[model samples]
Target: MTSTPPSPDAISYFGIEVPFMQHIGLRPLLLDSDRCHTLLAMRPDIVNSRGDIHGGTLMSAFDFTLSGAARAHDPERLGVITVDMTTHFYEPARTDLTVIGRCTRRGRSLAFCEGEIVDTAGTVVAVARAVFKLVVRQPA
Candidate 1:
């Protein structure tokens, strides 16, 4: 996918409102509206017993970032709910991590996305493929 760099303020999505994402230090680095890039710092509170970033933490970040990708088609007017996700852990993320997600295909109802988590040195730690159902955003 091609993208221009995004400013910190450029990211504005429901994922940022997620309490768990916030608790885990998942920060949106970019979301040029079609692709989502996120950062998570490795900290004691967010690690597994082995002292590496936990799989659940990685999965949560992917879910939020991938959902952002699905919603990017029409963000303000669109919403998404996860239909399914398949994730694979490749290694223990021992340092800060970045996740990037992009929509591979989008149909009228379902959008498919793929994402990966990489370390500061660009080693991939995990990957996830997901499907999300598009919905209209209801007025608050």
Candidate 2:
């Protein structure tokens, strides 16, 4: 039987809890075997001096979202550490946004992932691709 999908707030978006991510206000929206979707509500804290969303905030969201996708296969049993990421900015983000991440390819010890950020009006804000090294999560 197909289980009920989880509500946004019910999910542990990062797989592993990360205080910094929490502080950044990234919230889990959806997670699947090969993809993850997350939300980032615009806040004063993430805004740059010029009043646009800071690029660093976008990058961090990409890192966390892509990592989540890379480990989505078995989040509770696996973890991923980012090896590298490249991001391109297409527009200045001025509002809340959604990040969609996909694991493009998976190997025994590494995974390739990509992510896109779109603002509330559906404008493309940024896109990123990354590599992550997979590791077994040790019992805490």
Candidate 1: where is the Cα deviation over 4 Å? 1-16
- The lDDT per prediction is 0.86, 0.90
Clash count per candidate:
0, 0
Show the lowest summed lDDT stretch of 10 residues, model 1: 7-16
TM-score of each: 0.87, 0.90
Q: Which tens-of-lDDT digit does each residue in 1-140 have in candidate 2?
A: 45455455553655656657778899889888999999999999999999998999999999999999999998889988899999999999899999999999999999999989999998899999999999998766
Model 1's lDDT to the true fold? 0.86
Q: Give candidate 2 regions above 4 Å deviation.
A: 1-11
Q: How many pairs of residues collide in model 1?
A: 0
RMSD of each: 7.4, 6.4
